[model samples]
Target: MNSQHAQHSPEILVFDSSDALASAAAQRLAAAIVSAQSDRGVARIALTGGSTGIAALRALRTVGDPIDWGRVEIFWGDDRFLPAGHEDRNDAQADEALLSHVPVDAARVFRMPCDEGEFAGDATAGARAYEETLRSLTPDGKIPELDVHLLGMGPDGHINSLFPGKATLSERERAVVAEFDSPKPPPQRITLTFPVVNAARHVWFLVAGADKAPAVAKAVGRASPADYPAAGAQGRDGTTWFLDKNAAELLR
Candidate 1:
């Protein structure tokens, strides 16, 4: 493992293998959550979904850290606009990986509104409802002050459901939006907008696999957000990119 501190852009943490990356991230997250709980009564985290993200969650479950799950709040970075329990949804993955095993307050597990029921399978309705929920979390109606916001980078430089060249990348006011026409399947998705994602106290990117190398380079290079959505994500306090050797290969 090699950790490099950067003065300008996000610090890059490179690991020999994806497993090592996930393990290190999980350990750090456990420490962060414990520290936050000591400073404040509660801790909040926005979890991401993907191979690497799930690995980290599982790793977190194994940590010996005395985390009071009951005092923690959980949220997702994004979810597929499918049924609440759909296997493809990020919420579903989260539950299987860590949520179901933890005793977090049910009220604080803020899962995104999925298709069906009152949402009527309308992505737009779910997006609006999520925005309303976010606004209600804090008194000032601004986006919630996220403790840790985890994200996954797509091979094309997308984050959450915000893809490169998508008009949603230009969105400013909305905290959440319905992502339509996504390059990936199950296009309809509910994703946190840039303004909200960038509001986090810390942003962590979990990226693995050789396919992500190009995207990593572009994101850290001169590519615009319009061309690489990942470039738009900036944490208020700090941003860290956790990468496996393959993913960091092209990160010159």
Candidate 2:
């Protein structure tokens, strides 16, 4: 880990199992959103999609819906460039898991442009449009400071759509970028860069399963972001790793 990152090491919370982790994350997320809304009148959160991520969203449903959904602005960390309503799309999974159960204002939900929209299959155009949408939310024309940015890490240590050693890792200016050749399928994707992710007041990584143990160890050990994108996701106010015992087992 570099000196800068070492100075703000992530807070680690380990659970007995993935189910326990998801339930805890869901409760914490609800509280965080309510707290943000209390402090600022509105809360913005970026969601992630994956087994653990979606499970957390689903678990949120059992929490009695304490959040004022209408006052919460939702965004995504990254999503495949598929047509709208595609089951594989992150937003669609999110809708099925949580959004549909809540009373969130439709206008406040900012889903990344789909492949069939105005951009129409052009990944770059879609990315640019999403970036514009993010900038439009801020008075300074910068990416909005999200209250919380939730992430799920791949076994290879990737975060969002940013795979290890990918050229997109070098991106510093653009808040969102198109991943034309993702190592994982769906091939094309749109993802928020490190700048936008780190701008969040809180970056919470929800990881589980024994398969993710090694990557969790490396990220917590402070590996270079180019090698482990999760290492690059440091929130301005706080960074946390919520892990299942299987995932935290390998952590030092």
Candidate 3:
């Protein structure tokens, strides 16, 4: 990690179980959105997809009524390049998990393009279009400075679609990029680059499972992002790790 990132090590919050982590994360999210809206009239957040990520959204549905969802702008950290409404798509999972229960403005929800759209099977085009959307929302023609950016770390230490040792890990110019050869299934995907993720005011990582314990330890220890992508995700204001006992077990 760079000196700037090293100066802002992540704050660790361990939970008794995944369920507890989800509930706590949801509460924190609600508070964050409320605080941001109180100060700025709107809140922008990026969502992640995975068991733990979805659990947090579901938990939010129970405690998020205090939030003025209509003024909240939603974006995804990454997305599978499947057709819209595909059960496996992150946006679809998010809609089923939380959006449907909230009164969020449809126009504020920025979903990455799917394979069946005008981009049509072109992950690169989809990524570029999403980048344009983000740029349009910011004065500098870069990515939007999200209020809160959520992420789920893979057992392999990847975050978003950025895998360890991949060329995408070195990306500094683009705010978004296409991942055509992800180690995980349904290879084609689009994801926010580290620059965009780091542009957020707060980055919250929700992780669970014994399989992730080692990676969590490495990430917390400030391992090189090229070797542990999660280590690269630091927020401008703060970075936090919300982990279950299983995930934090190896932390020193």
> Which of the numbered candidates is closest to the native, going by highest lDDT?
3
Ranking by TM-score: 3, 2, 1
Ranking by lDDT: 3, 2, 1
> For candidate 2, lDDT tens digit of each residue in 1-252?
121333487899999989999999999999999999999999999999999999999999888547999999999999999999999999999999999998999999999999995888798999999999988987988788899999999999999999999999888889899998988899999999888888788999999999999999999987999999998888878999999999999876
Report the Cα lDDT for residue 108, model 3.
Answer: 98
Note each model's CA RMSD in angstroms: 4.1, 2.1, 1.7
Per-prediction TM-score: 0.95, 0.96, 0.97
List model 1 lDDT by residue over 72-187, tens digit each.
98888899999879999998998899988888789998989988899966899899988888888889887787889999999999999999888888888788899879889997
lDDT of 1: 0.88
Alpha carbon lDDT of each predicted model: 0.88, 0.92, 0.93
lDDT of 3 by residue, 102-159 (tens): 9999999999999995899799999999999988986877577899999999998999
Reference-based lDDT, residue 30, model 1: 98
